[model samples]
Target: MASGISDAQLAVFVLSLRRSNPPSDTSIVLFMDSVSPRAREIMEAHAVEGVVFDKSKFGDIHPSTYRWPMITEAVEGRGAAVGNVLVADIRDMAFQGDPFEVIGREGGGLHVFTGVEHITLGKDGWNGGWVRDCFGERLLESIKDEVIICSGVSVGDRDNMVGYLKMMSSEMDLPSFKQCERNGVDQGVHNVLVHTGRLKGGGVDVKVHRQGGGTVANMQAGVAKYRRGEGVVNGEGRMVDVVHQYDRDGELQDHLFREFVEWDMAVEGVGEGGCEGYIIKENTEAYKGICDLSHDPGSDYLECCKVCNGKPNCRGFTHIRKGCWLKTCGNNGNKELKVVGATGAWKV
Candidate 1:
């Protein structure tokens, strides 16, 4: 689920999912507040099949908290028609492989991914505060040392996920939960339920996967091993199925952005019109620049493209090797030179 995401964010996610080779029968249900026309068009162009866009709103409750309830209702409505269900964050998420590949065989349980090996509820400031505010300091103290169970991504059987989502939804309605303004209180609730054995009491089996050893990787919590073409990989060096919180790492983020951009560009009209108001040219370099802008130290063309796109009066940028030069056309001086091993883009 997503809210207030840009076209590029939406494009990267759906496009990555489509590229990951999900089963032919798999369906994608997007519970989002809004999606621009350009974003929808990008999804269609990528041949993202069996997608249902749900725009349901839960008054006053933040999307992060309300998504559980929404997912609960959706799962219950589907009955036993679907197999496994994955609840994931959108904007910062990308797929390297089929997410359902491992879950399909696991069967009838909630699969939770933990954060960095040693980081716990009390140690991580954001999560610690959320748990304290929404649940209480006592609850936080109870499982303070336990490895944090992240709610950013989760997988389970249809029935089990429904039960889990129902519990999360019911908890969100509590006075303490409603009074809390924090966006990710759901993660606190999630960790509480998993560590406290609440789901087991409710007849749901919970399986916890450790960071760097699981199918899902949280780039923000741990030092994730990232490859240019493979994305994030586990200890075995195989590409992980889902990469969450990827935006936390600048280099990884740029790599994935360029990968998605390259992929989008391959699909004819997708690159031209999907992101909107910008044209991307492969193997092309900007001839002249008004000024040069440095990236995040080690960043490449992707960061350069991003910088130029966001900067006002930055008509274009030329990427060469490890550097990118921002350009401004003076009397139409911004020319596209066909330079190999480079990319140029400009906002019209």
Candidate 2:
């Protein structure tokens, strides 16, 4: 499950998962601050299940504080219905294959993945500097070189996963966590807990999956390592099942989205039929006046189509030189002002 995901991000994430995994094999649960109309539209369009949680319930604390509670809810709510659970970030993430299969092979009790080690310590990384400032230099020096744990993707058996979340929730109340607030507390506290062997005592059997031969991969080092068509591979040259933190690199993020998500959406005729339960008027003029959605004069017609398709109430769009306008009232807004050089099309 994920939280605070925007409409566009949710669209790609849900669509990509559907393309990669069949409904019989997997179920998706999304946790968000609140579901907006657009979010509801996307969820309905993609058939994704969503759960709402109020971030304000946690009181004056870091936003990441909600992660533990949301994850715990998912784990306990599902109960024994699902044998395993994967709590992951929705943004900048895509599934190339069935994540459950990977988790099954990993032999999970409680599995966590390691991110880039270079930035885990020293003054170079913000997390490192924050750790020193919060916990003091003494604690920082003790585990400065240890590999930082990424809280993005985690997997385990239902009971063990719930146990881990319970432990993490309790840790958030510690006094030291106050100093680490607003920083990367999720990762910092998680790493500290694991490094100190605190989770082991809870029967978590914490298994750390490093860079290679792991189900989930963290692309914190940038996009140089991932080839265009071969997918993201680890040191062992095996394709990673789930990729996280890809947004760190804009170019790579776009590349992956286009390959894994956009292509499938286009092929599957998603939003190709204009508004749902409405007839679209093609090659018509929006003489009533145009409502420009994008000001980019050089925007492509296909892009305009996509923008209109994503909007739930959009009935049609008019494309002109470097401008795109989406109409909500269908073909009855106004017939007075004639728009010159605008070609209108329905989102089929």
Candidate 3:
């Protein structure tokens, strides 16, 4: 299934990035292997470069049937000379500052730096210092393996990323992967590769940043001595570009994101063609379809949306009978009604 984030959040992110990062010859690229029906329409309407599985490349089957392998394929022959391949899984990002400037090119090496709660790290609860102060080492170790990574947003040179990408395509579990609903398995392989010293060939670095101390840091900020390593995940050397509040729910996250979007809008207005400028039609024939799928034979609105399979920039969707509503997301529901309401003269 596609991620549960709404299209509005995505629109805000793209818009924010356009203004924050501005642009250069560096063509910011956003890639997705499989795009849902209406979601594709929405993103395309916005003018974002959206890629779906090329049938010539995919054939008639669930694209996810070959997820890891295919995603690894998409990364191929792409990131070589791009300004900076700042890749973000659809659900794995929040654009705080200009990611273009913040996320360095892979030339420096493979690195993932995101702010996760300091309470969680490795197998043990907290290292000797932070959590130890709270519960001591013995108690912390008791809950080892119970932790989850918040978001280790990595950055790197990505020169030979194709190499590892290819390897993963071959090594990633296939049909048998149904039984492997484990952690981010692909990233697990990546972690193993980096820690074991496998990605140093064409020069890519992998680094992570976990939340431990009080404040976030930028390159010039006071990070730890070891975190400054060329490829250290959970490093403290720099202020994070985005903080993933993964703990929150969908609606609440939207509320929080509004502050961010409004801040950006205030700072620099809507970006010229930054977001995939989309508008939804209200009272169109589409709503009847939404009412059908929404309360339909299978009330799993989310699952139906999942069956649709959305990708990056392919923001939120509403499944219906005859057709689906692709764009029109801002807050709780479709934005057309709210937009009309604000107009006052258009109300029924």
TM-score of each: 0.72, 0.68, 0.48
| lDDT of every predicted structure (CA atoms) | 0.70, 0.65, 0.38
Can you write out model 3's per-residue Cα lDDT over 1-348, one digit (the tens) per residue? 123434444555455455556544434345454555544555554456654445456444333334545545555545455534554544424444655443443225444442233333354222322323333456435433332332224443455445555554554454553343233444444443443445554244554443443122221122322222221112434444443432132332333345333322111112112222322232122221222222212233344243323433234334334333443223244332211001100101
Worst 10 residues of 2 by lDDT: 262-271
- Tell me the tens digit of each residue's lDDT in model 1 across 24-130: 65667776566566767876676543234444545566778767777787778887787878888887888887887767656558888887666667899988888
Could you give candidate 2's per-residue lDDT for residues 1-348 as a string of tens digits? 455665556765777677777566667888777787877877776677887777787677756765677667677877778777777788667766666665568676888988875565554466676666666788778878787778878877787788888888787767876766773667766776677678898788898988766767788843225767676776677777777876654445556545543322211123333334333333234533355443333275566666776767766666666666677645453442222234555543
Task: Report the number of the highest-TM-score candidate.
Answer: 1
Q: Which stretches of candidate 3 lie over 4 Å from their true place?
A: 1-5, 23-46, 54-68, 102-107, 114-152, 173-183, 200-203, 212-239, 245-252, 256-348
Q: How many residue pairs clash in each candidate?
A: 0, 6, 39
Error of 2 at 199 (Å): 1.0
Number of backbone clashes in candidate 3: 39
- Per-residue lDDT value at 291 in model 2: 51
Superposed Cα deviation of residue 327, candidate 2 (Å): 34
Task: For residue 149, give model 3's deviation from the true position in Å.
Answer: 5.8
